[model samples]
Target: MEQASRTVRGQGMSSIKEVVSSWSDVARLLRGGDSGALVPVVIPRDNRGLRWTTLVWFGLWALISGFMLLRGAWGPIAMVVAILSFILAALWWWRSSIVEIEEGTVGVLTKFGAISGPGLAPGRHYLWHPWARVAYVVDVTTEIPYAAPVLSSPTHENVPLKSIEFFLRFRIVDAIRFVQTIGAGNFDLVLSNSVQDAIRQRSRQVRTERAYDLRGSDVKDMQELLNRQLTRYGVQIMGCNIPDVQLPDQYREHLATRERVAKELVAYEKEWELTRKRRIDTLLMEIERSKKIRDAKIVEVKASLNKARKDVAQMLEERETEAQAIRYEIETQARTNLVAAQGEAKAQEQLATAYRDNRAVLGYELARRRLDVGANLAENAPRPVIVHTDAGSADNSALSTLLMAQLLPQIQAGAASRSRPALRQQPQPTGDEVAQAAGSAAQRAVQAVRGRQK
Candidate 1:
C-alpha cells in the first residue's frame, strides 16, 4: 500500500529521467514494474555510477551533523560547517583517486564521466574523482583444458558404435572478446561444445576404418585441426589428443584373420620363388662345367692328332731313306757280279793260251822218257859194242865201221882158236857165236844212231 501511494505521487513527475531525481522516486518506479519486484531496490540505487569518494563524503557529513546536535552547540552553524567539511573532503578524495592493475590483469576505469582506459599494467595509477569507477577486472592468466570426442566402427560387424574420447589444452587470448562472447562462467561449456563439433565435422569426412586405425600421429592432427577452428572464439588451443580407440568384437576378429591369411600366402610364395631360382642356377652351373670339359677334351684330341702326324712323317722319311740305301746296295752288287764274271772269263782265256803255246813240250817229254829207258838198258847191258871210226871218212865210215866191226870180231876169234891148238889147250871163239853177237850189236848201234839223228 505504501508502494502504491509512492507510485501515485511519482505519477506527476512525468518523464522517467525527471521521475528518478531522488532515491524515493526511483524506488517507486521499481515497485511499479512487476519484473523488478524480485530484484532488490538497492541494486539500481547502489549501481548509480557513484564514486567511492562521494559515498565517503556523504557519510562524514551526516556523522558530523549528528555529533553537533548531541553536544547542544550552535546547531545551524555547525551544520553549515559540517556540510563544507564534507564537500572539501569529497574534493580531496576525488583528486587522490587511484587505479591498480596487476600482472596478467586488465583494469578498465572511467573518469570525469568519460572512459579512460583498459590499461594492461601491474601498478597503481590515478584518475579524476567523482565520475571515475572501475568498470571491469580481468584475470588474464588462466589456463583452459578441453577434449575431443570421436566415434569409430566397432570390432563386431554387427555393432558399430560411437565411443571414443580425447583431450585438449587451450588458453584465452583475447580477454575482451572472451568476456563479450561468453562470460568466464560459460567458458567451459563453449570450449567443450566447439571441440566436439569440430571433431564430428572432421570425422564425417573420414572413413570408419580410418578412425578405427587411428594412431598417435592421427590424434595429434585432430588436435591441430581443432585448435585452428576454435581460435576464432578467443580460445588458444594448445593440444588436442586421442587417448583411446574402441572397436566391436566381430570387426577385430575379422581383421585379425585377414592379416594372418595374407602373411601366410606371402611367405609361401617367397619360399617357392627362392627354391625355383636355386634349382635353375644349379642346372646352369652344371651345363657350364660340362661345356668346359668338352672344350678341353677337344683341344687334347687335336694335340694328339698333331703328334701322330709328326710321328708318321718321321717314319715315312726313315722308310724313304732305307729304300734309297737298298737301291744303292742292289746296284753295287750287280756291278760286283759283272766284274767277277769278266775276271773269270779272262782267266779261262789265259789258261787256253798257255795250253796252245806248249807244242814242243810233248817232244821234250818223249826225249826224257827215252833217256830214262836208255839208262835202264845201259845198266842192264854189258860193254860189248865198241866201234871206232876214222876221222877222215865222216859219212861213209860210219856204215863201214859197223860192218867191219862185226866181221873183225869174227875173224879175231877164228884166228885165236887156231893159235891156241898149237899152244896146247887154249879156247878160241867160234865163227857162229861171233857172228850172232856182232849182228845184235850192229843192229842196236844202227837204231841208236838213227834215233839220235832224228
Candidate 2:
C-alpha cells in the first residue's frame, strides 16, 4: 500500500510535458478531438522556438532571396547571383521539409479529413503531399496516477464503511486507439468508477471488525478485472492497491476496550506461571538436602559396625590363648605326682624286710650263749652254794628290763678280767680247789641272773 501511494504521489513531469500545449491541441481533445490530439511537427522546432545558430542561418537565406528579387535582370553577375540564390533557397526548403517527433511520443496522420497510414515513429519524416500533416500526439512512456475514495460503501454484512481510498498507475499502450477512443481528459471519470466498484466489492467481503485488513491486501484480481474493462481503450493498470480504510468512530472505541482487557489477561497468566516455577525450584532443593543427610547416616552406621566386629575378634583370641596355657599347666603337675608315688611305695617295702632280718639274728645269738653256760656248769661241781631271785615284784620287772639293755657289756668285761689271771696260773686242780672255783663261778652266775631279774 505504501509503495502504491509513493508511486501515485510521484507525478514529477518533465519540462515539455504539456498535454494541452496550445489552443489547437485543446480544441482537438475537447471539441473535435476524436481523431487525435495534434502538435506541430512540420517546422521541426524544439520547445517551439528557433535557436541562435538557426536564426543566424535564416538571415543568410533572407539575404539570398532579397538579392534574387532586387538585382538587375540580365547581367552575368545578376545571372550567377540568381543561380546561387536558387540553389541556397532550394537547400533551405528541403531541410524544412523533414519533420521530427519527441522520443516518448508518437504522431498520427490525417489527410483530407480521413485516417491515412500508420503512426510515425519519433524521428525525421517527410510528407508526400502538401495536405499531409501530423494530426495528433500521444505519450507512450509515462505512467499517470488515479486515486478514488469510495465513501460509505456497503459491506457483506450490510455495514456501510466510512471510506476506502483506492490508488493505481496506468500507461497508454495503443496510442492510436487511446487518442481516438478515450483521451486523457475523459479517462478520469472511467478510472474513478472502476476503482470505486472494485473497492466496495472488496469491502463487502470483509467484516466490519476486520476492515483494517484491506489496507495492504493484494489487489491482483481487481487489477485484472479493471484491465479487462479498460484494455480496449489502450490503457493498462501497471499497479494498484487500497491505500486507506477509515472505520466508524463507535466501532474503533469498542476495539480499544477489547484490546485493554486482552492485555490484562496476558499479564495475569505470566505472573501465575512465574509463581509455579518458583515453588517447583524450592521443592527440588529440599529433596536434594534430605538425600545428603540420608547418605551421611548410612556411612556412620557402617563405621560403627566395623569397629564392633574388630573388638569381638580381639576378645575371642585372648580367651583361646588363656585356655591353652591352663591345659599345659595341668599336664605338667600330673606327671610329677605320679613319679613321687612310685618312690614312696618302694621305700616302705625295704624298711619292713630289714626289721625281720634283725629280729632273727638276735634270737640265734641268745640261744648260743645259753648252751655254753650249761656246759661249764656240768664240768666243774662246786660245794653247795645258793643264789635266788624274787620274780613277783613290778619293781623287779622294770629293773630287769633296764639291766638287760645297759648291763650286758659290763658283765662281759668282768668275766674277761677274771679269766686272764686263771690262764696265767697252773692248769690242774684238786677237788677242793675245783669246788671253790665252782662255788665262785656259780655264785657269780646267780648274781648275774639276779641283776637281770632286778
Candidate 3:
C-alpha cells in the first residue's frame, strides 16, 4: 500500500507542474515575451471592455483586502495585499486622466493655465488632471450655423428693410486661437455678431428691389467679410445665405395693383392685334378672288378678239377671190372684142381692094343694079320698057354698051349729088333724055318680034 501511494503522489506532482508551466506561458505572452518586464500602454476611455475589466479588478481587490482585514491577519501577507490594492487604485485613478479624441476633433491641451503645444490629434492621449489638462475638445469638421433677423436701410434713402433672416456656416480652424480668444461656449454668439455686422454694412449700399436681384452676390460678399472679422479668432466662415425677405405691407400692395393693371393692358393689346390680323387676312382673300375673276374675263375677251380677227381674215380672202374672177372675165371679154374687130376690119379692106382692081366686075354689078331698077319701074309705070338682042350677036357687046350709055348719066348724077355739100344744090336729070331712051328700047323690041314671026 505504501508504494502505490507513492506512485499516485508522483503522478499528481507532474500534473501540477504541467498546469504551472501553461500559466507561465500565458503570462509571458501577455508581457510581450519578457516575463520580468511590463509593456507600457495607453488605455482609451471609450473602450468599454477595458473599462469593465478595470472596474472588475478594482472590485476584486477591494473584496480581497476586506476579507484579509476581517480575518485580523496583520502580518507581511496583509501588508503586501494592502500595498497591491493601493497601487491598483492609483492606476485606476490615473486612467481617468486619459482623454480619447475621436476623428475630426482636436484636443486643446493647457499646462499651468497656458497653452503647452500645438494640439492633440485623434486617438488616446494622456493628460494629467491637475498639472496638465485638456482644455477643449473642438469638433473642427462640423460646420456650425448661426442665424439672425436684421434691420437696415437698403438704399441709404431712409427705406428700412426689416425681418431679413440671414444665416452663416462656420468652423474652428485654429483650435488654440479659438480656445484662447472666443472659447467654445461663445463661438455661436461671436459668429452671429460678425454675420449681422457684415449684412448691415453691405445692405446700405443696395436698394430693396436691387437687393433681391443681388441676393446671391450679397450672400457671398457677406461670407467673405464675416471671415475677415472672425479669422483672427480662429473661426472660418464656410457660407452665408439669405433664406427669407419681407417688404412693407404698403409697398407689397402697391406692386400688386400695378401688376394687375399691366396684365389687363397687355390682354387688350393682344385682342386688338388678333382682330387686325383677321381683317388683313380677309382683305387678302378678297383681293385674290377679284384677281382670279379678272384673269378669267381677260382670257374670254382675248378668245373673242382672236375669233373676230380670224373671221375678218377669211372674209377678206373671199372678197379677194371674187375680185380676181371678175378681172379674169373682163380680160377675156376684151380679148374676144379685139379679135372680132380685127376680122371685121380685114373683111372690109379686102372688099375695097377687089372693087378697085376689076372694072368689068364693077360694070357687071352696075348693070345688074340698073336692070333691077328698070323692072321695078315697068311694074309701077303705065307702059313697059324692054330691050331686044339679035340671035346671031353671040357676044352681047352691043347690048352691054347700050345699057352703060343709058345708066352712065344716072350714075354720074348720083355721084355728083353725093359729092355736093348741100343736097338742095344737087343736079337733076332732064325729062327729054328719059323719053328718048324709052322710045329707042321700044322700037328695037318691035323689030325683033317681026323678024321672028316671018
Candidate 4:
C-alpha cells in the first residue's frame, strides 16, 4: 500500500515536475543514490552570449541615464544617473574582463587594454570596462594526466615493466603563451598530448630498469625533468606521481624464476668456495708435512756436523794451548835476558854520569844543606827566624863572619818586629784609664833601655 501511494504521488505531479523528477532520478542513478528533491532544466545547446546579452541590456539603460544627466538634469537625478552609469560600466567590464585562467583563477580587465584586477581568486568577480574585451579565459591551472606507454621487450631477458599513468598537477605559468601555443579552443587536447609527449620522451631516455627500480631519487629526477621540459609550453608540471605499475602475468612468473635462479646460484657459489677452500687447505697441509720431513733430516745432519766440529775444536784448542805455553816460555826467557842486559848497561851509565856531574853534585849538596838549615829554623822558631848557614863555615873565618853578620841583621829585624804594636791581635781597651796604663808601660820600657845603656 505504501508503494502504491508513492506511485500515485509520483504520477499526480504535472508534466514539468515529472520531467524534473525524472532528471533528478537520472542524476541519482549516475551518482549511485536515491533522489529526494531536485529540479532539472533543459540546458541550451547554443550557450553563446545569453549572459552577455542580458548584461548589454542593463548597461544600455545606464548609458542613456548617464547621457541625460550630463545634459543638465536635476542634481539628485544627475548623481543617480552617474552612479548607475558607473555601476553598469563596471558590471559590463567585469563580465567582459573575467576569464577562467589555469587552476580555476579568473582575470578581469578594462576596455582600454588595462587589466582590471584583483585577478580572479577562483570563483567570480565583477568590474567595469571602457573599450577592452576579455581575449581568452582558460583554465591554465589543471591537473594534466600523462601516461607513458611502454610495452615489454620480448628479446630482453631482464625484468619487464608495464604501462604507467603519470599524474601532473600543473598550472599555466604564462597565459598569453598558453592561449597562443596551446590554442584556447583545444587546450585540453593540446595539454594532454604535450604531457604525453614529454612523459614518453623522458621515459624512453631512461632505461626500463631504472624506472622499475622504484628508487625515490630517480622518480624525483624524472619529475623535475618533465616539469622543465613542459614549462616552455606554458604548462607547469607541479607534481608527477607514479601511482601504479602494471606487470604481465608472464612477467610475474619470469621474475619468480629469476629470483629462484639467483638464490640457487648463490648457494652453488658458496659450496664451490667451500670446496676450493678445502682443496687449498689440503695442499697447504701437504706442503707443511714436506717441510717438517725436510727440517728433520736437516736437523740430524746438523747435529752430526756439530759433534764433529766440537771434537775438531777441542783438538785444535789443546794444540794451541801447548804452542802457547812453549811460546810463553820462550818470550819470558828472552825478556829476562834483555832485562839483565839493561840492568848492566844502566849501571855503567850511572857510573859515567856520576863521574861527569861531580861539581853539580857538590853544588846540589850545598843547596840541600841550606834547605835543611831553613827547615830547622822554621820548625824550632815560634816567630820568624833567619838562618845564615854556610857550606864552608868550618875552615873559612870570613865566611863565618859573613854568616854571623847576616844573623845579626836577622836578630835586629826580629827585635824591631817585636817592638811594634800587634794591633790586629788585641781588642782595643775603652776609657782614658786604659790609655794611661798603656802610656805608663811605654815609659817603663824607655827607662829600662836607658838603664842598660848606662
Error (Å) of candidate 1 at residue 115 is 7.6
Clash counts for the predictions, in order: 9, 4, 0, 14
Candidate 1's C-alpha runs over 4 A off are: 1-102, 108-116, 125-143, 150-161, 185-189, 218-232, 249-454
What is the C-alpha lDDT profile of model 2 across 111-165, one tens digit per residue? 7756577688877787645456666666666665556677788777887887787
User: For residues 1-454, could you state the per-residue lDDT of candidate 3 as single tens digits?
Assistant: 5346325423211100001122113323222322222111111122212353465476566667666676675544655665676676568657756766656767677777688899899888875454676555555776655556665435445566755667666677887787677654355446545655776776777676555543545467677777788899887878778776665667656656866888898888899988999999999999999999999999999999999999998899889889998998898777666655554454445444443433454456567667756754654344333446688877677778787669866765675567444534644334454445445544554445444433
If both were scored by lDDT, which would come out higher, candidate 1 or candidate 3?
A: 3
**RMSD in order of candidates:** 32.2, 26.9, 31.0, 24.0
Whole-model Cα lDDT per candidate?
Answer: 0.54, 0.62, 0.59, 0.51
Please name the candidate that would achieve the greatest lDDT relative to the true structure: 2
Question: Which tens-of-lDDT digit does each residue in 62-174 have in candidate 4?
Answer: 55665766666554565565566567655655555443323343333334555544344545433333344443343444443333333442213344455544554556666
Ordered from best to worst TM-score, the candidate numbers read 2, 3, 1, 4
TM-score of each: 0.35, 0.45, 0.43, 0.35
Candidate 2: where are CA atoms >4 Å away?
A: 1-18, 22-95, 263-454
Candidate 3: give the clashing pairs.
none
Single out the weakest 10-residue window by summed lDDT for candidate 4.
Answer: 37-46
Who is ahead in lDDT, 1 or 4?
Answer: 1
Question: Candidate 1, residues 28-109: lDDT per residue as tens digits?
Answer: 4333422322111111222334454565666576667667686675666666666776777666665556544545555445
Say which candidate scores most in TM-score.
Answer: 2
